[model samples]
Target: MPELKLLLKHKARTLDEYRRIGGYAAFQKALAMDRQAVIDEIKKSGLRGRGGAGFPTWIKWNGIPKQKTKRHYVLCNADEGEPGTFKDKELMESTPHQVIEGMMIAGWATQADVGYIYIRAEFMDCARAVKSAIDEAYAEGLLGKNIQGTGWDFDLHVHLGAGSYECGEESAMMSSLMGERGMPRLKAPHAPLPTIAGLWDSPTLINNVETFACAPHIIQNGGDWYAAMGASTKNSRGTKIFSVSGHVNKPGNYEIEFGTKLSDLLELAGGIKGGALKACIPGGSSVPILNAESVAKAVIGYEEIGEVGSMVGSGGCIFFNEHTCIVALMWRTAKFYMRESCGKCTPCREGTDWLFQIHDRIIKGGGRPEDINLLKQICAQIDGRSFCGLGDAAAWPIVAALKVFPHEYEYFIQHGKSIVDTPQSKLMFPYAEPVPV
Candidate 1:
């Protein structure tokens, strides 16, 4: 494996060690140029948000209002709630300076005076590490006021999220930061385009944790350097952190360039632990599932996966080998979304429970043939129609599982029990785990 350590390496949390590696050089470089020039550089670099949306960073920055405002905020979203997506926590805990430096450069580009790192409550350790790095930057005057004596003052604070997946949505994050419940806001008001109204009526730019971490490298090496690291897809550029889990032997994070084969990523994880490669969840549990043959051909970038009927959402590669029962897997995966559903919209709130019911009936050996079609139709209705991605998120595994393993589902309906004919079902469901009736 060609291990080019840009985001994962570096033990230094202090400004001095970060400086030794040409860290803040980007911030310093950005300070010398006009804001639009910096934005142009990011556009040229082909940098997209690493938090799964893959939106162009330059477009987001440029979307901010240029008119004079009393306050503007640059918020780094550290709420890594996607299942199997721990890459952000790794970057934050291991090489925090990169994230801080990147955010400061972002703040400089956007003319934001204040920045906040809204971290998940579960990631307390990463929060501590990042907060410590922030303190070190402040000591070196890298964070607070008149940065590098350029008369550009930017201050950063770390805020803790109450730990909801919906908070990962940028608008919900803003509302939560304002001491409101962590529910996603409608897009029409649209975060006011991050230029007009953000974080208490100021221009605010909120980016995922890893998105900001990639900035210093782009700034230091020039946009071309970062752009050339991955596939020539319009949006997928630079390295991606794949947090491999499930049946994989080496279930940990693997930092590889974009466009790396899904099979190669699984090999990096030492392949599936015991069973034959049955299925894979290329993104988090949110994106659709890919069968074994398709997994072998799947590439690691955003546009690459889009061609294969799935998305590269959050880079959480979950492997499920032969011994895994699809009905049982769907049951558990649906249960996660049902539990984590913010209960906001009708489709997500009600449909999540409906999915749970269908999967529960199937896994318990009471499925009907028509239930398969029902699952697909229900998921289709939920995928694009819900309030946010969570509806789609809850629907993905169900539809994907049905698409790839229709026969396995059929066998369950025919037998009126698990095809495996094992006693493990009882162990899998200890008690009647209640889903909405």
Candidate 2:
């Protein structure tokens, strides 16, 4: 509850209501200042993208090629398809205008002509909510043609994407927006950066929904004001909203300043649901899982989470209690990425399927003696060689889980069953009869 600056109040839905609650003031403040001044304020506030990468927002905007003749674009990535990550969906549903306002400020900063909030097709609620807000903003003279009499014209639209995890990557998002299949492109140094050449070869400022939602706050509160909230850790400033799930009694979004203890947040979510906490996934299903001890010691900041060999990916924390099988969890994780692979890259398209097969076999009491080594080999091939973050994210958790709980994998191999088999997995199993694990 750390005085949420992003989540809107109960009645803060309409343009008038949001304005009453001090909503669009930030965009107005940004409009009054020099365009560069808005970016400068964000740079000064030390605001990093809340989109899991934690990239500095100003740096991304500053990187956009500033050409007067060329049209620039601001793209808001609302395709929140990452497993266990729902903050963006909830944020948009609660306050679509906030995200839109953030986009307006970004448009002004980057001198963009148009913007799109690419929401996932599965998020029908979020899509409808954002679309309604956009229409309302347009009707109220807040978007499209001379917003608030600032003599600046910016148009925003909602582009619904066929929910694809790979599309969550900015480059893939641009491709999908262009009516192309969602897949990643190789980002080489020789090629122009996306900021310079994006969205049909124009400058595009791509940021996540949560990142844009913070723009107004940064502009209104001053960069230093937002920067001073969390621990002064490198790349870890201001507040973040974490979507906590799995084995938590009160699973939901919890907004807190950085450097808050992970254990404290778990407690805020009412601790483990049915049993003692066994492990935690600090970021999302994509990042590495932390042992119970490491979970206890971990803090809320990105850098601190990284120090524990896990990333604060999209700020989605999924905790599991002792009854949960660590290996089974990894199996589920691998299965998800395998099914979601965009099939553009050779490694990810093939390697992810291979991983799922191995996990499936391992959980079914058919694990080979060399399975661990094989998992290591496949993970190495997929981690650094894939075209985008999706492949790397897919392999990260499995690799980390194997390293942290090698015994769990070994137990299934030796005992011919999952270590923590329960009724749910038993009923869901597609393999041989159960045995001691």
Candidate 3:
């Protein structure tokens, strides 16, 4: 498989080391080009936000208003709080300089005079690394005040958020950075969108760690170099670093081009840990779960994952062996959402709690026949009705669990719990061997 680890090359820490590997040459190239040309280059790359939403990177930057009187901000969303996801944390700690360079490129392209990295407080190492890189950049005239006599001044800062998952959202992140509660804002019409009114109601452009990190490379190696790497399908593009975990024998980060099979990815991760692969969460905790049958058909791009009725969220693939209990797995997943819900909306705040409680009851041998039906009902209200993506994201996997493995819920409802004690225990969605199709 062709791998594109633009920001993963080792020994590229200090400015000199980074320059040796052709580091900020792209920025110099970018500086020479017109601002619109830089934006066009990024747009041509077909790079989407690696932060789950998969939004086009250039469109977000292009949306920044060209008003000199109003402040424009370019932010790097490093608050990687998704369960079963940790790629951004590693990127920040390892290739801090790459991230800084990417941010600088974005700042220049968007005409943003100021930039900030809103990293979670839990990522103290990431903070240190980014802050250290920022200082190094300032000393070398790579950041702050004037840059290489371009007369474009860009100041960068690192703001530590209080480790709230809600703050991972762009709106919530802006709120947390402003020293306010980390809750999602009420999204309104596009007359004054985030590009025009964000982070103190100014034109702001935000991109996740991986998304920004791609900028320097895309600029260095032309848009065609990146657009040619990933799936042939229209949406998912470029190589993605998936944080593989759960039940996999060799769970770790693996960068592969899009359109790879889920089963092939499992082989890359050394297959199932101790038993047959029963199911897998193709994306992070937020996306829907893929059944054993569907997993066989599932591919490794956003469009393909969507075709399987799941999302390529954060590229966090979590495997589950046949021995794993579906109800218990979902119960734990629901509990995470329940605890992490920002309580900003009535449906999400209350609905996540209800989902967790129901899953708990089903797993604890206290489920009623109507429990699964009721769960489906609660998920309906929470799926699209929530204020932010959190509530909608939390409801997706639960709904997927119901669809792909109805027997798991039925078994829990009948037996009051999942008991894989005998061969008879393997009822529906059996994957004793999980052979690739």
TM-scores of the models, in the given order?
A: 0.94, 0.95, 0.94
For candidate 2, lDDT tens digit of each residue in 1-437? 33354453343556777788788888888888998889889998888888888988899999986666688999999998878889998788888888999999999988888999999999998899898999998998888887778777899999998778888898889999998888776574967777888899888899999899889888988999888878456668888888999989999888878878899899888888877888999788899999999998888787888888888889889998888888878877888898888888899989998898898888878999899999999999999898888889889998999999999999998898877776754544545633222
lDDT of each: 0.83, 0.85, 0.85
CA displacement after TM-score superposition, residue 398 of candidate 2 (Å) = 0.8
Q: What residue pairs clash in candidate 2, if any at all? A: 45-223
**Candidate 1 collision pairs:** 64-195, 65-195, 198-202
The C-alpha RMSD of each candidate to the native structure, in angstroms, is 2.1, 3.0, 5.2
TM-score between model 3 and native: 0.94
lDDT of 1 at 99: 88
Q: What is candidate 1's lDDT per residue for 109-158, written digit by digit as tens?
A: 88889999999998888889989988988898887777788888889999
lDDT of 1: 0.83
User: Where does model 3 exceed 4 Å of error?
Assistant: 1-4, 422-437
Backbone clash count, each prediction separately = 3, 1, 0
